[model samples]
Target: MTCPLLKEDLIFNLTQGLGYEERSLALYEEFLTMLEGKELSAEEIHDKEIIERIASDERRHITIAKRLIVIAEEYYHTT
Candidate 1:
C-alpha cells in the first residue's frame, strides 16, 4: 500500500518546483528579449551568457519536475 501523505507531499513539492522553474524561465526569456538589439560590453555579454545557461538549466528542471510528477502519479495509482 502506498502512503497517501507521502504521495501527496511528493506531488505538491514537484508542482511547486515546476511553477518556480517556469516563472524563472519566463523572466529569463523576457530579459533576453530586452537585451536584443542592444550593444553589450564584454562583461555584459558574459553575464548574458550566464543568464542563458541558467535559463537552459531552468528548462531542464521544468522537464524533470514534470516527468517526476507523472511518474509519481502513476506509481501511486498502481500501488
Candidate 2:
C-alpha cells in the first residue's frame, strides 16, 4: 500500500533516516490514534484496511517507520 505520508513533506522530513527511529515511531503512533478516533474519509478508510492488513502481519510502527526511512533516504539521495 502507498503510504499516506508519502506526499507529506513534513512527515518525509521526520522519517528521513534511521537516526529518527524513536520520533518516527511516535509520529506513527499518533497517526494511528488519530485514525482510530474518527470516521475515515473514503481514501483513509481504504488506507486503514491496508494498514490493518500490514499491522496484522506483525509489523509494528518501528518496522514500518524504518522502511519509510529507507525510502526517504533513497529519495534524498536522488534529489
Candidate 3:
C-alpha cells in the first residue's frame, strides 16, 4: 500500500513549489513591464533576455506542478 503520509508530503512540497513559481513568474512579468518603452543599455538588455528565459521556465514549472497535483490527488484518493 502507498503511504498516505508520503503522498501528503509530496502534495505539500508540490504546492510550495507551485506557489513559488507563480510568484516568481509574476515578478518577472512585472520586471518586463517596467522595462517596456525604456531605453536600455547593452547590459540591461542582456539582463532582460535572461529574465525572460527564467520567466519562461517558471511558466513551464507551473504547468508541470498543476499536472502533478492532479495526478497526486487521483492517486491519493484511489489508494
- How far is each candidate from the true structure, as Cα RMSD in Å? 1.8, 11.6, 1.7
lDDT of 1 by residue, 1-79 (tens): 5565688898999999899999999999999999999999999999999999999999999999999999999998888
lDDT of 3 at 65: 99
The ten-residue window of minimal lDDT in model 1 covers: 1-10
* Candidate 2 stretches greater than 4 Å from native: 1-19, 49-79
In candidate 2, what are the lDDT values of residues 1-79, reduced to their tens digit? 4444444574556556434555544555566777887987899998877755654443455577677667766765575
TM-score of each: 0.91, 0.36, 0.88
Q: List clashing residue pairs in candidate 3.
A: none
Backbone-clash count (model 1): 0
Task: Give the C-alpha lDDT of model 3.
Answer: 0.94
Model 1 regions lying over 4 Å from their true place = 1-5
